[model samples]
Target: MSKLVGSLQGYIWRGYLMAGKNTNKLLSGQATISSKSYAYSAKEIYYSTLPYAATYHKSAVTGYDPTKTKPETSYGAISRSVISNYQPSMTKAQIQTVIAFEQAKKSVPDFRIVDVPYQASDGTEMVPVVQVFSAPYRDLDDYDHDGKWTTEATVRNVLLAQENGSGKIFESNPEAQQVELVGPQYAFPDDDAAMLSSNYYGIDNTTRIIKRVGQFVMLSSRLKSGIFYAKASDLITLNTNKPTVIDGIPYVTSMPLAPASPNHYVDTASGKALKAAGYTKVRTLFDDSMNEYRLKNGVWTDSLFASFETKIFSPDFDYRHVYFNVSDTDEGKIKSNKVITLNEGNNDFKKLLMAPTETLLGK
Candidate 1:
């Protein structure tokens, strides 16, 4: 009886070990099967959706060039055409009345009008008066080498001189003879709170007048009635309270106003003019704490605050005529001063102006 009991116990122990091994093998096989199934499903889904996802993902991974792609109808072109062609059924007098009402609402008390003269195509004199709302309080001793800050009288004198000249001012081109100031002069309040207020907002409002240098008079396009100094033969018109028809030509106050200069502030602490400072493409310092040390001859020194230096050279008295050079350890000497003359066949100026707008619109 004792032997039979021991044998039964031995058989039970062996059965327990075999069951444990079989259970582990079943679990391992199930795990392997589950992993294979998951991988197969994942591959199938990826392959199936590859055709659909390729349209969006491919362009993102590889940079897209618009010039290389086929031309497509753009929304800007469509919208511009629609806006230009669409006209309200309102009468001309009604439209003028509405415009007058808007102008009356924006009438500034401190603003005064100054008439600028321009010669018309038919040898007739035209005057386009601009509303001067603000002028520099501090007198400029010798700004622009013209002996003083630009004023209405000074601008007029410059234009008169240009008109009296027998030969063109620019030797290479006749159209480039006239040099007009094409930017906002007034220094508006930088405070955002003051800008939001209606009273202070219109107080700093000023107009941009394109007066030819040495012939200081308003300029107009030769083919059109607008204020555009494209050629020497461009006409000048008289300023009126409203668009007035003198003789046979209709004279209207239609000139593009220049926006305020972005580089309006000067950093007095650093003795650097914010807008006048040269642009740096790369940073030299490895850390922000190294700003106190300056890079000299490829070695860092604690004497200066900057790691690099920039120099701007203006060859002629022309403000636009400028050449810039930067000195750095990484780049020994870099110069950037390529002149692009705006002649009859050259569209470089137009391309430069449009490039920024196009990049913004594309994004």
Candidate 2:
């Protein structure tokens, strides 16, 4: 069972959804309203499906028409009517770009202007990992020679300036350029309840101190990582030669992980445990109380707060970006102990967190 990126949220889940592996089996066998009978107003589906703005239709001109009877209701019917949204599953190369940017900015503070939900060329308006600079926030000041916190610019300029991929991919193919430009931006919500803040800066809704530097470039991919990111100078080193042939194929030079720190995070104990289980490039996230480990050999290996509330770094194994996941919460609260196994480069594998804890079991 090969793993593939999940179509809905863009996280790497187990098995290939296209191949129809564990999808149905993973389901609760629930049914939705649209799955049942007549067509509901697109408006209803819009609000119910996306949570935000209301989607309305033009009112009928004059008189009323049909007097049809309303149908039965259930959690199954209404909720299931959800329109599954596909998000950007960036390649290993793309993921590294975000990581490099974040790594570059180690001192800059976090900043937010506005949230503008957008639709990609793919017709999906998934959460952007980064937003705000899409249109220049003319009011904000533009500063340079600092860490990742970029100065304000119009939204459009931000998008263009923040593009990824070698120009080669775009030089010959305009269609491909459109696709890359519109990929998902991983948006990290400052406040789930407060929604959006116009002038709110440096403070969480409940007044908790929110870390300005986002470890992972998620929710929206359009917002490029700032200079304060980890990659700073060590991310990708430029090579000078174009090899005539490798295994028969000519080699082209490009940026690759520069192998910055010798400090690979791993618990010799956890390392021994997982290695005994056949894991490679496996490392741990730890502190005073918890010790969590994730395998880097897989396609998508993020330290998801949906599992643990702590932070972790996720880079593509083919050695692309280094997306860090740094959380402000306590280590014990994180869904620490788990195993993510894979079969191929950065986009294929299984995420299995068998024991959801960070402590050692006496057994």
lDDT of 1 by residue, 1-363 (tens): 001111133222211111222322212232312221110111111001011111232232111111122221111111222322221222223222322332354652222111222222122221212122232233476432211111122222223323443233222222222122211111111111010101110101121234444322333322222222222221222232232333332222221111134422222222122112321111112111111222244332222112111112323322112111112222222222122332222212212221221231233
In candidate 2, residue 351 scores what lDDT? 18
Model 1 reaches what TM-score against the true structure?
0.18
Root-mean-square deviation of candidate 1: 35.6
Q: Mind giving the per-residue lDDT tens digits that candidate 2 earns over 1-363?
A: 111133423322212111222212322222321121111121111001111111112211110111121211111111111212222333323333433443355642232222122322223221213311121122345532211222232222233234632112212333221111111112221111110111111111111111223332211212332111121111111122322222222211221112234523333343444445554322221111112234445311223221211112233222111122222122224433333232212211001211232322212
Best by lDDT: 2
Residue 26, candidate 1: Cα error in Å is: 99
Candidate 1 Cα outliers beyond 4 Å, as residue runs: 1-103, 110-114, 118-125, 130-332, 335-345, 350-363
Q: Candidate 2 regions off by >4 Å?
A: 1-110, 121-244, 247-363
